[model samples]
Target: MSEARADIYARITNEIVAAMEAGAGEWNMPWRHDGSSVARPVNLISRKPYRGINTLALWIAAHAKGYGDGVWATYRQWVERGAKVRRGEKAATVVFWKQIRGRIQETIDEADVFDVDDGRPRFVARGYAVFNRAQVDGYEEPDAPRLPESERVAHAESFFTALGIPVAYGASGAWYRVSEDRIYMPDFGRFAEPTGFYSTLAHECAHATGASHRLDRDFSRRFTKQAVAAEELVAELTAAMILADLGLAAHPRADHAAYLSSWLELLENDRRAIFTAASKAQAAADWMHARQRASAAQKESEAA
Candidate 1:
């Protein structure tokens, strides 16, 4: 890996490490948004949500700098929109990759690489700097209606139903039964809040996404002894991303809090661990989103 490319991974991993350290005992990671407009970090110019590591990086910057919304854009993109980034405002790092035929890993996320038909590796990592809307001027926040709790819950139910994963309730604990290819959860009534039920369900669904026939995300080779920890990190991150997209608060699962130490160790030992986890998590979330889209399309066809 070139020194330049390595810097990108180190920078993002270090920032997240610092944030996690800061929130250590409190269990408040940078990804914990207050169910405000900051759910999914989006670009001001394209109006599209950032994905994977970029989302986490922006969330860390926003949490540290106290930004209230998730909108962000490149300095040039802001200028193009007639908004000037305020003087002396530092930019956050967003990493992207370009496809290239090479054997060099180049500090890219391992999960991003694939063998083309010709058997050459694809992808080279690059970084971009972006400023959040909070650091810009001459722009106005768009008005978006917030869904009520009832509607949010209904939507959450529909989303999981669309995935078609068999979920068994009344279990003593919440977990994805990989052997049975199903998810087992405690009864919904047991959760202190309705949102908690969905949050936990989202985590299990993320785990289920790794089924052999599904995303097929395997961490054993890359993580070695830390494979389980890596998988947990992926599932946790995936659940947080999904809940944020659903416009719901992402509460930390009590069961997962214990894994914090392992996560820290995994990230500290490996510069690419977080990137690999984030990439797999993003794939899982995208899989769920695709299912939702397919189900919606099917329903519309039936109605038509």
Candidate 2:
């Protein structure tokens, strides 16, 4: 990298680290199927031989440039430890490069490497496909206190409108697009009950706030399950932040055990990720807060 480019990389990394420290990102250990214990995948370094360009780009943007010596020292420690595992000098709990390659290879041997006409070799990126072990049994639904029905609907409508998106009620719960204009609710009937309805909407509305139209967040494409889990952490954290700001208590959901493994693996592999994700979460939350303020101001003006 050129000196200028290197500087930019460092700056991005520093920003990411700052974000993580502020509760925008979370780091944890990988979970196992037994639900009673956790273990790092054994092939942490030997499995996957390389990193993806997008992952590297994001990492650089979030960590490299502006960090202080103290931060750099911590990062160095992670790298050194990771390197040792990669070199087969250490026994790591998390599986690395080689294991990743083996998993991919098992799915497709000798993947078509290039377009015959273009003569461009296809590049394989690092990602994971593993069993889910994390449990969501302990999570409790959001507390819906005794808010009026009209108030809940109005809140949901305003939240979605601010982001210029449509809401879709689902069977189980709701999900909003961060990259597109889609609202997903698993089963609306299930949530038809007073408390269920608002709680579900609240979750989706929180997602809408992170949409590109609203927060300009980069939660669109994540190659690995770990990366995806990391993004989820950002989303959930952002939701909690919003709920807190609105004087509402946040609730937990189930079925995150599978993601727990990836989440923990990523954290063990990259400490800087915690910082980067946290920063992005905070940015998303700030963006949503700003929109709420703007919307309220517009409403007041209209009334005037």
- Find the candidate with the highest TM-score and give its number: 1
Clashing pairs in 1: none
Pick out the ten consecutive residues of candidate 1 with the lowest summed lDDT: 28-37
lDDT of 1 by residue, 42-108 (tens): 8777777888888888889987875655778889998888888889999999987777764553355
- Stretches > 4 Å off in candidate 1: 1-18, 26-152, 250-259
What's the CA error at residue 118 for candidate 2, in Å?
61
Error of 1 at 1 (Å): 28
How many angstroms is residue 112 displaced in model 1 relative to the true structure, after the best TM-score fit?
A: 62
TM-score, cand. 1 vs. native: 0.52
Q: What TM-score does each of the candidates earn?
A: 0.52, 0.41
